[model samples]
Target: MTVSLDELMAALTRELKPEQFKDYCPNGLQVQGRAHIGRLVTGVTACQALIDAAIEQKADAILVHHGYFWRGEDAVLTGIKRRRIKTLMEHDVSLIAYHLPLDAHPELGNNVQLAKILGLNPGSALSRQNNHDMGLVAQLPAPMSGADFAALLAARLQREPLHIAGSEAPIRTVAWCTGAAQGYIEQAVAAGADAYISGEISEPTVHSAREHGIHYFAAGHHATERYGVQALGQLLAQRFDLQHQFIDIDNPV
Candidate 1:
């Protein structure tokens, strides 16, 4: 009913293979807590809200997709950052996170999970970086209008994606990258995807999609990434026979 923090960290690192990817933040065990964990909480971000929710759930370790210590972020821990880390340390809760590794995972990645939810069968990788695919191209069972595809995403993700319908043609191929990967649309276009889906969209994305005639969907970053951490937590909970809870802290962006 309990697993050591080190042991859990090792297992996660082994499964995710963080060493294989170039990530912004450190992965696997950001903060040290009690030696053993009996309750685990997983979420999209390690914000104060998630930490508070984890404490309410009496979690021993908090696992997340977005952790602290980015590449160009201010090195000093202050304000919100200071408070978040303090809360975890005060409560003796460990913080474990996986970033690029979680996104690039073949079976349990965020893109794959989103594809599964939308009933899209993956056909090929869209962007290959560091010897791993960052996004995936999926084959729809049948071609559908861009509007229809956007509606399907809204229904499945429980959030209306900002759809930029580029072409009137029915879409049979879509490429998806979760969490602020709208920049990968070029790769999707290169792959001849009828539509491209990602968490966020930029001004350039609008022009690219319109000019290239590829549908673009800007789903919420938090909403699109909610599944991967939960899936990983569920697997670990089942494997270690520990209590696992996935807490969602709503974020509009």
Candidate 2:
């Protein structure tokens, strides 16, 4: 069973509501590719390599976390940007991206998936900025030592997490936002989280963690966010009966 690009975009827009967000890039159908999609590829970023892989697979569409036409990016398509768009257009492969909507979705969101993986019983949004909270605040099923918690995160995310143990106290309340959201530590603290976890960290994050008495974990940004898009791809694959593959591009930062 094949789904047209227009049909897929309509379903996704209805589910994600890209219009509701003030994102860095255009949310849906950044590049018009094939008219009909029989195979889909999903990834964290729409990099050149991923595009090439999709081309190799003869993918009808590429779905990703990062796409083009970002707020701060150069609008004119040239250089690497032009090349990426040209490749997709030449192959008639559609590019559909979801940014914040992917992050904030209750069931299929990055934060929610991360919380589930970390064994946290999510309660509410850690911050109240967007319509829904950007991150999740959850209660740990049982208290665990900071070291043990770090070990758990490392095991689940498959990256050595940067752990800043603030106090000797165990962690029972946790908050997390995926993908380089170190700035949200304060918000997590405000949410009364004993610990905060995100993908990347700054030097000052150590000082903030120690002073605030909140354990901080810098899990890999690429690692923490891999689940949401994969889940979304699976759903789309099942719903549309399209072949789907999740291509992972390793990023140290």
Candidate 3:
């Protein structure tokens, strides 16, 4: 079975509701390719490596969370960008991206998926963007010490989070936003989260966690963001009965 590129795009835009959030990049099909898609591949980003892999896999479309033309990036197709776009065009493989929408989707979002993996029960939105929150606040099943919680993250994500412990107390309430959301620590603090987990951390995050008496964990951005696109791919494949594969091109940051 196959789905028209238009049909797939419409389904995605409806499911993720990209129009609701103001994002750094466009949230749907970024490149035109074949009109109908039978084989779909999903990945974290639209880098040259992922495109090459898609070409090798004979994919009709490559769906991803990160695509080209981010705000403030030079509009010209040059160097790596040019090579990537050219490769996709040569293969006639469509490139679809969902930035904030993929992050915030209620059932198949990055933060929600991460919460499920870490056994955190989601409670409320972490912060509002365009009147909808892009992250999640959660209640832990039981209190776990800060170090224990950090260890749990490392075990699950397979990457050691840089732990900035706020207090010796155990973590009961937590908030998390995936992929470079360290700036939302203030919101986590205000929510009374005992700990805040995000993809990347800045220098200022250290003082904020300590002064605010909340734990902060800098899990790898790539690691935290890997789930949503895969989940979306699975759903699309199941819905349309198209062949789907999630290719992981690992990144440390």
Candidate 4:
């Protein structure tokens, strides 16, 4: 079954509510591709490689976590940006992106999906600013050693996480956010979390973890975030009965 790009965008915007967000990049249709979409491709970032793969698949629409026209970025499209837009326009493939909305969704969100995959039960938002913030406060089924918790994250994310054990206190409550959000560590502590998890680590983060008596884990950003957009794509695929494919372009960072 095929759906028009306008209809799909309207449905998605209504569901995701991209207009309500102050996101890093444009949340929908960064590049206008085809008018009628029969096949869809989903990925983490709208890089050249992912776009190429979508083109190869003959995808009419490409959905991703990161898209163009970021808040602070140059408005002028040139060089790599120019090429990327050119490719999408030439192929007539529509580009739709979701950032914080995808991360904050209860069922199809990145943080929720990460918790489910790692066997943690999410409780509430760690940050009060946005109930839909990517960071979440969760509780473990039972207390686990910091080492064991780190190992569990490693097993699921397929990367050796950087663990900074705070107090020898057993870990039961935790706060987590996917991608580079080390700044949220304090929010985790304020939320009464015994530990915090994010995608990247900074030098001060280690000290902050130790001083704050909260364990900190740095799982690979890309690894921790691969699930949400894929899940969203699957849902869209099933809803519209369109052919959908998820393209994984590995990023170590």
Best by lDDT: 3
Worst 10 residues of 4 by lDDT: 126-135
User: Best TM-score goes to which candidate?
Assistant: 1
Model 3 is weakest, by summed lDDT over 10 consecutive residues, at 126-135
Q: How far out, in Å, is residue 104 in model 2?
A: 0.2
lDDT of 3 by residue, 1-253 (tens): 9999999999997898888888899889899999999999999999999999989999999999999899999999889999999999988999999998988888999999999889888999999887766789988888999999989999999999999998888899999999999999999998989999999999999999999999999998999999999999999999999999999998988
- The models' CA-based lDDT, in order, is 0.91, 0.90, 0.92, 0.88
Candidate 1 lDDT over 110-179, as tens digits, reads 9888888888889889988889988999888888998888889899999999999888889988999998
* lDDT of model 3, residue 42: 96
In terms of TM-score, which candidate is stronger, 3 or 4? Answer: 3
Please list the Cα RMSD from the true structure of every candidate, rounded to 1 decimal place. 0.7, 1.2, 0.9, 1.4
lDDT of 1: 0.91
TM for every model, in the order presented, reads 0.98, 0.96, 0.98, 0.95
What are the per-residue Cα lDDT tens digits for candidate 2 across 1-253? 8998899999999888888888777788888886889999999999999999989988999999988887876678889998998999899888999999999888999998898787778888887545777998888888989999999998888888989998789998999999979999999998999999999999999999999999999998888999899999999999999999999988876
Whichever of 1 and 3 has more lDDT, that candidate is: 3
Runs in model 2 deviating more than 4 A are none
lDDT of prediction 2: 0.90
Question: If both were scored by TM-score, which would come out higher, candidate 2 or candidate 4?
Answer: 2
| Residue 12 error, candidate 4, Å | 0.7
